[model samples]
Target: MQRTISFADKPTLHGTNVLLRPVQASDVAASLEPDHEADRLTGTHPTPGGLSVEQRQDWYATRADHADRLDLAVIDQATGLYAGEVVLNELDDDNQSCNFRICLFYSRNRNRGLGTEATRLILAHAFETVGLHRVDLEVYEFNPRARRVYEKVGFVYEGTKRQALRWDGEWIDAHVMSILAEEWAVHRGYPEAPAS
Candidate 1:
């Protein structure tokens, strides 16, 4: 049976030159492409599991209707192309916090400041709409690009787990980062970007 979930109807978020909307059936193809390639480059950081296109589709189908997870498709507004994907996963029952992850499928889309803006939108929604106290993430120390983006949005490095992830044939450290609602409030300087 297909599970149904109720989410904020209009999950539209604007970035510097892109927009993030809830992931849909049509996006499965594009979203799967970059994710497959990214696996080879980074080799699954937090979760040591190998990547597969079918696995990604199944994962998306399962959470696509889940209320607790806000999975989004990153779109380049200028060309109307899919840039990547981002999500707020594992929401707590108290509605006080959740974890986030983002992946840009196309390498050309990187270094264009889209990540910072996209992250800002997600962080804004997490604090304002989700009414969460904290938003946290784990980054492989090797993924400095993502770490930089998170830091730009005020996520401080709280700690690190040495050799927490095994990729290829080696183990690597993972950085733990988090940001409080109070800190996010100050960064956006808004009352709250209401939940849709």
Candidate 2:
């Protein structure tokens, strides 16, 4: 880990399956469209269709300008197409930690290890290259798939925020999970090594 923190470089990190690069306006087709499954998994509450496409475009257009947080577009290597995004935001510089999130745009991208690989790549950049002491994320109990991915990447379960979200008439618990730089040193991303 470096002594200083920096997300200004907007790095292009590569994996065997995907490439993580800075997102641009040209990557903005259907990104603003409503994804019901994505929304449910992330527990995102829709706000009456008031989202501005132009504003979203402007946001994507200027992703490279931010120095405080990392937002990389996940691109499928075989197709050379935009898959989704993985982000590290809410930087707490004093504590050397940040919040993490990832989302894929299409159904074809799910259940195929894209999110897992993307999580591993960004967390690597966070702890190994970006000099963060810790990276954390929250996953609602309804989304076991995401929780499992975080666990596979070595994030320890911190605790649960009870009744944190209300959806489809029932309350859900949000689990807080985190991984420290030291833990990354031991496991990198995979907590358990694959069978030789």
Candidate 3:
């Protein structure tokens, strides 16, 4: 029998540096701060403008009602502040797979290992608790730091989508990566292979 996974049980996942919990409307303020560096690093399209307070609040407020996807707020444990977000979306039940994405909204949250811990916590919940068979992601070629983080967590380099993103009139490649449940069973988060 195929194992079914439920994204509805939004659990608060704790790590050494970060805590991943259900998103709240109160998170609107911290999460809405605009950072050009962050937008560039994530290869996000420039929105016409920043979201209004009401729009952000309403967006976060409805996160709990979505059963098909998991959206968690990344909290910096030391300061207990909203650091960013980690999400598992585009769920394919028949394939027991989903897409993973994470971002630290501000410069303060980067380089502190918060994103790494948050990534591990969510992947653990995805494979061990949710019984997912696969999780995948795409990283822009310009962002090797983010790609390295995904590699350290056992996501294997699958392939590259050439010129998948167009930023400021220049095209950029997007590297595809994925991790299987079998791989996760062995590595959990850190892979055992010797670093090249």
Which stretches of candidate 1 lie above 4 Å from their native place? 1-10, 31-37, 40-42, 45-62, 189-196
Worst 10 residues of 2 by lDDT: 1-10
> In model 3, what lDDT does residue 99 have?
98
The TM-score values for the models, in the order shown, are 0.80, 0.94, 0.94
Clashing pairs in 2: none
lDDT by residue (80-171, candidate 1, tens digit) is 98888888877775646778888887677778887778888887877777677888898887788888888877888999999987777788
Model 2 vs. true fold: TM: 0.94
For each candidate, the alpha-carbon lDDT, in order, equals: 0.75, 0.88, 0.90
Task: Give per-residue CA lDDT, model 3, range 129-181, as digits (tens).
Answer: 99999999999999988998999899999999999999989999999999999
The residue-by-residue lDDT of candidate 2 on 31-146, one tens digit each, is: 75668899888888878865577878888898788788888999999899888999999888878999999999768888899999999999988987889999999999989989
Query: How would the candidate models be sorted by lDDT, starting from the highest?
Result: 3, 2, 1
Worst 10 residues of 1 by lDDT: 1-10
Give lDDT: candidate 3, residue 21. 93
RMSD of each: 5.9, 2.4, 2.5
